[model samples]
Target: MLKISEDKRDTIIAKLKQDIDAANAYYEETIEPAVMERYAIFHADKDYYRKMFPRLSKRCEITSTDVQDTIESTMPVLMKTFFGSTDVVTIQGADGTDEDSDRAEKMQELINYELQQNKFFMKFYRWAKDALITNLGIIKVDWDREYKEVQKTITMDAEAYAQYRPQAEAMGIKVNAAETNPAGGINVTYTAQELAKNRPRVMNLMASEFRFSLDATRLEDADFVAHRKIVSIDYLRMQGESGMYQNVEEVAQKAVAPHYTTLDTQNNEYIDEQPNRTDTGRQKVELYECYVNLNMSDDPDGRLTPMIVTVSNGVILRCEENTYERNPFFVLSPRVEPHHIWPETGFTDLIAQVQHSKTAIIRQMIYNIAQGNDSKMAIDTAALVDINDVLNNAQFIRVKGNVSEALQPLPAAQLQSWTFNMLEYLDTVKENRTGITKYNQGLDSNSLNKTATGISIITQQSNQRLELIARIFAETGLTELFRFLIKLNQLFINEELVIRLTNGPMKIDPSDLDGSFDLIVNAGMGAGAKQTNLQNLQMVRELSTQLAEVGLSGPQQWYNLAKRIIEEVGFKNVDDFLIDPSQMAAQMPQQGEQETAGEDSKTTIRSAITDAPWQVQMQFWQKLGFDVTPQMFTEQVAQKVLSSAADAQAKADASRGDVMHDRLQQANLARPRGGGRMAGTTSNAGAQAGGSTGALEPASQYNGTMAGNAAGSTTAGVSSY
Candidate 1:
């Protein structure tokens, strides 16, 4: 049984209760409103049915009057007698008590039964009557005797009555009374299904029936007014003597300048002084190179003012008075200066060249070729070619011309010198490039170093070598030179066949072509023996046939030989022979087994106690003494030895157990034991000896004895309880 601490148990209980409470609270607060809303919608539907049923019954009654005049006259009487005569009729039977009251329960029951039977038709009838009276200006049946006598005295017109009957019905009223006043009363009857069909139309009419009046005048009389007193104050104050007005006047005075001047009469001072003619109103107007000075103050009343003028194209006019004073004020035309010249020139050419070089380099990078002959130009071209070669293949390079044509105009000697100098320059600049003090700061030194230097050198060398080779080719026009070398290589490799197809007719021997075909097919089949060589052979044969049709005889001959090999030798022998070349070389003799001579030499040692009977059983304690007796080894000593041996064996066995057992035990705590069989002994002598031993002592006995010893030792240990 397991016992838990009170604190832990209490904590678990508290947490469980907290979760339960939270669940309960969530259900109550969030779920209740949705349930209430659904209930409200259901009740609203029931209310609509209860309130609309009477209006539906009134509309139906008016529709029934179309077929019979008596129906039109009797409808009112029937409503008064069967339903009720009240404005808002409480439908009832003939009982004098209120039809809904319990005292008139039978009458209420009768009314309800009648309502179920004819309520829809009755409502439609009522709606038709009201519609006819309102829209067609047709009269409903007069309940008063005066209207009934007049209707009875008028001669009934059948055609007029028939034509207007439907219109009258559509308008929810009856016009059939004057035409159908037969001695027997007009008859009208309908089933529930028929009434239901018409019920919607009746209900729609009732729904649309409305009363309107001129209420706008009444609304106006209730709230309209002719005059209203505004309580707004003036934002701008008049400039009177008051302080508020004075403040406004001061503000206005500051806002606008005075246009007139006044004189001070008390001191006889000219309040508005006439300004000096030359100083106050002097105007020097410069019209191009001319200056016109007008003194407006000379005419005190501002009439025509005298003006002084001077004109000069490029000279200054100085008016020197009789006083002999130098006047600085003189009109002088500014001299035009020649256009300024830029200090430096030819930068544009240098810029354009640099741009052209950069553009060329970029274009070469994309096209995978070197172009141009200048030093920087050649360097850029080489760099670009190197970059492109690193990114793509040499075959993609655009320059197809031989090396000599490619290098024709280059200054080879000068470029070689410059390349060596550039190498030296790179070596010298490397330290500066990487950084003189591990902090790179020199731009010019860094510019000379690049990771692509090796590629650049290789590209330059390749171009030069190609150019040299092209020069040789161009000068000698030796078209067969490369082909001759290839042919020699092929001959040395023992591949002599040359299959060619020409526009002219040529005959090919099938056997010769099949042999070449076999060579190629066998080469591939040799490496992949597991593949179906026959399928590959068949495919090659078909492709070769197709190629032959297209005049590609070389490939056809190769494939044909492959097909012959596949058909003749079969895939097994052909694949084996191709794959293992030694199989085709020579057959070696099978080796026979050689007898191993046993060693006759042996080592012998003298017995320590020859005369004493040998005790092989007691060999474990042989080092103790030869005189030791079996009985001298007591159970305790035996048990102790067994325990020690068992303990040591257990420790050793733990290390020696099956690795799988250790893994299973490590992975699972409940691993079952004794589930695997021990390995069988391989030695015949050991097997026979083990059989003769009558199954060795059970391991349980040794374990029990060891456990007993362990128990005894445990008993002697210091006890805490």
Candidate 2:
């Protein structure tokens, strides 16, 4: 807590007030009219009717909420694109784009783990987006200690005091300095209880917190102050950054709401319970605290440029002048007016003008018709009790003479055809200016029925207007958010953060993370991405298939592209929504084995089996120890039984012939040693007719089929010799 003199505090308040007053003046003069009109559009009641058509206000109180509804309709689209349900922010480390590096990988995991624990995107992205669209979007990077000493009330007797006081003091517990107690020992707060075995080991953990601020309530635009270089600004009359921050806090204290927290769930029946510090009507609110950032400082690089002041209950709770090594706040706009500090245009701004015109014309027409419908009458005053009661009731005139009254009709008023034409023109203007229409807004009517494709094409073409705004926001706001997260990592995280990744778990070592990476915004990505992505993936899918067919891509590469395609189609990551290619490793034949076994031979054998009946294929495969089923075998499976049997019998005969020939050769060699003369070669005729066992079976055996079916049958002439 920094001290400020009474005189100085008043001076600081005066200075802050002066700036606020001046800013408010600018707001009221230039921007307030449009904002008030927007409010009228939102309310769409008497004020609106008066604003649009003063004369017709009493007659027709119809005010359309089209603009407000259209604006709201854009929100979900923006959210889906901005913080896509899949991957929104990518972690780029100081070590360049190589995500495989140790530090880079760890940093990515740390960010992921933090996001999972905090749900910053899930909870706050949409709120911030709303702020961006109408007002100013902001983000703050916070780093606070996760661990705290337990605060428990403990009573001590003299004996317990003697034992506990020494131990408590050793553990850094502060004791109350009361003089003496009427009781033997004093009751005091002991904060040294080390949560231990009584608590399960898993329970011993610290949960980090995430919070987002969508405060644009009292905010006067920052770009106005910054770009205008609003000079002659008075400071809080402090010496340094810290002192100035303290003064800013004083200002915020006066502005923040008293008993700010509502504590809606503190007493809810469905909500789970937690230890809470509660007051009577409004509880002690740690979560509902508010913040103000004065980002008008001249020095862009110096500390306290965007000074932070936090307050609750009309008192300054925290004030600090620091940086996230970069600006902590991010500003976004859906559309910006040219040469304007703050964009005064929105999706429905122009629609109001048209709506007002249409309302005035319709109301005037109704008024004219009503006046004409009330036919003028020349009734004698004596005939009626009162002139005011002339048309009050259907009266029977007492005059017997035929009333020479003719039902004269006023000249029929015809609305010009161009009135509708002008209304159509106005409608066209609204569609042109805002890119919003009944068709795009999903308003159902017989007159306007556009196909979704036609509507989508028109919508996409119209998005060109918003795309530039989004690009500008991405460049400034998104980059700042990345910087904020990096600084938090550097300041708060000390333990290794485990983040599950596609390859494996990456341990994000905060100390090793060097936050230096470019923030790249893909124009083809985000809100409009879903449509373009589908088209692109369709094309890429074809190209990928062609590449695979041409042997230019491997299975792994194909798999990676497939995962991306899955995501491009707005599905979750491949790991969650798509089947993993690696999961089929067990089912696939190993590379070496497949090659060594000769695929050509296997293909021939498989073809033969495939051409056979399902039953026969199953029986043949069963003999070969293959688990084949009738359902599993396709028509491609052929003559399995006949092929396997013939091949087996042929193999058996070849083996027997080789064995007999070898034995006969050995006998011939032995006979020669016993002094038998070597007969040159047996006459071809002798072996042809009745030959020795070792002699060839002429050419007949070699030419014809040697073996019969493998059911132990052989051709009669077929000889093993």
Number of the predicted model whose TM-score against the real structure is largest = 2
Scored by CA lDDT, what does every candidate get?
0.27, 0.48
TM-score to native of every candidate shown: 0.10, 0.57
lDDT digits (tens) for residues 1-721 of candidate 2? 4354555334434544444446545554555455445555654556758865676877766654555655665566656666663544555554455453556546545665565556555434543444433444443434533334566766667677778778867876876542236766667665554422110000100001112221233123331121111111122213124242233434423432222111223223433333232422221223112223443334556443343333322234344443433323344555555444445676445567766677787777676666667646666554444555445644643432344432223454666678778877876886677655554455647425667677667767766544555566666556556556655676666555556666567665656775565444565654564777777777877888889888987777778777877776766656775555666665466765776467446445555654566688568656754433343343112222323444565566567898765665455334421112111112223323322111223334433423332232222111122
Please state the error at residue 684 of candidate 1 in Å: 15
How accurate locally is residue 81 in candidate 1, as Cα lDDT from 0 to 100?
23
- Worst 10-residue lDDT window for candidate 2 reads 199-208
- What TM-score would you give candidate 2 relative to the actual structure? 0.57
Report, for all candidates in order, the number of backbone clashes: 32, 12
In candidate 2, position 436 carries an lDDT of: 54
Off by over 4 Å in 1: 1-448, 452-677, 680-721
